[model samples]
Target: MLQMAGIAVAGSCLSPTYASKSRLLVSIPAQLHREFTPPLPAFISLNQRRREVLPSKSLQTALIRCFDTNKAASAESEENAKPNKVYFARDAIVDAAARIAPAVANLYARKGGQEEEGEMGSGTVIHEDGYILTCSHLFFNKMDVTYAADEEIIVCTQDKEIGHVVDAYVDLDIAIIKIDSPSSPLSTAKVGSSSKLRPGDWAVAMGSPLSLQHTVTLGIISCVHRKSYELRREGMAMEFLQTDCAINPGNSGGPLCNVDGELVGVNVETMKAHKASGVSFAVPVDLISAIIKPFQSCQMPVQPYFGWVMRNVRKENLEALKQYYPTFPNALEGVFVQKVIKGSPADRAGIQAGDVVVDFDLQQIRNIKEMMDVMVKRSGTPVDVIVERLMLGKNRLVHLTITFEEKDVAAPRPRL
Candidate 1:
């Protein structure tokens, strides 16, 4: 899902950024099977990484240079001296990078039904215990092997060695991963209530945009209470915190924080057509919280589901319902119920399709979200349903009690 900033991660960890250098060392014991190492060992420079080190004065100097040299250090400085902070923003991002990047990990995986390397994705470490949250597709198949951060994960300010996801549910398109890393720099971002965000609020996205580690981009809330789906991603239904933030490929699973860096949402998708522009999208933080209960302590609690769909009335179709619905107050511009599923609490309460649901209890219904808010609070018990049913071009006031059924989470739904 590391595909887009507004639409999806297209739903993965990230796109590819093959490292061109052969200098970085890697070592995997030959006894280690595919279960613990990459399936295709050829693509990886294992021999180069496996070079052994010896302890000596010269080795000490080499090791020290490797450990202490910062990316900010110039080639000349790195050759003769230790590294120092050269830029303010880099310093700020690096300051929190270790703590934050651990949550955002690079995911290497296999392509669908093929014996080849698939694309990569990123993840966010939500739990200090090493639990992470990422787009589920990053681990999309029977993985031949997996890897995490190495000694240099800190250099990337990312968790180098992350535990692969042992469990996943694509219905939510979200996964929980166990990772290993040092203490975080930024406290896990404060998971604030999503309902607090409004259009035009400040937002900052932090992650490996385009696979460049610890990238940050800023924007404002473009819209809220989104009720949309990613048609390309098999119609994954996801309500998001729409923002103009510049979310690119590798930003998936990273945090969309407020001005103060409180976790508001997971950078998920970006809306795009022919040409890419400023529009971006993110998973609602509350939804991310709901999908993965594993991060409950680190994520905001999710609001409940109301479970219905409605539409605003169009003047062209208004005459068709003039008979049974008469309360033309304000032209019924609010959302109207289209269909209520059978055995749904609405059906149990005697509500039917074609019923123009105007309000719930007393709260006026706007769209799916507001109605859900009204119904979800009354989860088990019945609540009053107010509607104006069209009967022979006349308005008929109808009040029926409705209840909400527990959302059937296993109905082949997308990884929410």
Candidate 2:
């Protein structure tokens, strides 16, 4: 044997501690290189051959099974303690706001000399590709001025930084707007049944109050099926949703979302601000479907009544009128009978000039529009009516079964 000599080296240099952990780690190299094989432990003789076979899939499956068993056990352990859902526990209402914010939009209107400022109104996003539902008042051509096609209408939202206008609708008070996200993905509120939205279920309204955009207010659905809006021939009957959501001039056409974030009503006509010490009104989504249906049919529905002309009557005059309306509800039930046009539906229904309409179909008539609504919706449908002879103490609640008489279709009235 050749004499082997070596200088003294530290014990750390050839450490025995790592020998127990030593093993061969193998990989197929891209390029074949010369590699000297390391010797096995003395427990294995040099004559003993090494098994260089691939690991069996049975072994892999066994490892996976063990891991799965541990995981399932852990899952069962966790399941023993029921975790509280953060949304229902605390963020139920907040999540609703987030869901509904995408649908509501603002409206802007400016008359000829109204300082070129815009009026704030709300609208619902009814269609994904851009369709919305709002009140006629928002699009009511009070000034006969057309809003620009790309009017800078602001879309306010909840659970967000602020609101910005996305787009505008010219004919419909409804304005559809896409969210600010470059990504088109957004959570939209599922519209609920206005017919089923009871008077007690949670009622919520979103509006930009007094320049504060996307302000959320809460109230109960105070009433349902309240008489509202004049009816139109060939249009769906208007059944209203009345609420106390503190709606105002700005709240017109806002969405009255339910607790589930479903739109129960469209914030439409509200009580006059001074008259609104507490009450606010919304056009039920059921009725909204009617107003929009004619447009969908590509034809304008004939609204029977014109705009309401408001005027206050003195207490003495109101009392004097009550003498002729003993069957009417005190003195506030009926207003002065204006000129009824010849050959109109009101005229066909025998509602003549100087006829004081005290009540219609058991509903106490407070204004012309409400009475017109009942008469129009019930067109061809009979109703019990109460009217006082013009300037006479005699009054009668007559069940007048009105019929829909076709008038001259030569020239149609303007869209309301």
Error of 2 at 183 (Å): 10
Question: For model 2, which pairs clash?
Answer: 122-253, 253-267
**What is candidate 2's lDDT per residue for 296-392, written digit by digit as tens?**
3212234222212111122435654345434333334454433333443455567543455567778877544465456445533345666555334
TM-score of each: 0.41, 0.40
lDDT comparing candidate 1 with the true structure: 0.51
Report the lDDT tens digits of candidate 1 across residue range 220-248.
89888666653233323457778888877
The Cα error of candidate 1 at residue 255, in Å, is 1.2
Model 2 lDDT, residue 202, Cα = 73
List where candidate 2 sits over 4 angstroms from the true fold: 1-90, 110-118, 141-188, 229-237, 290-416
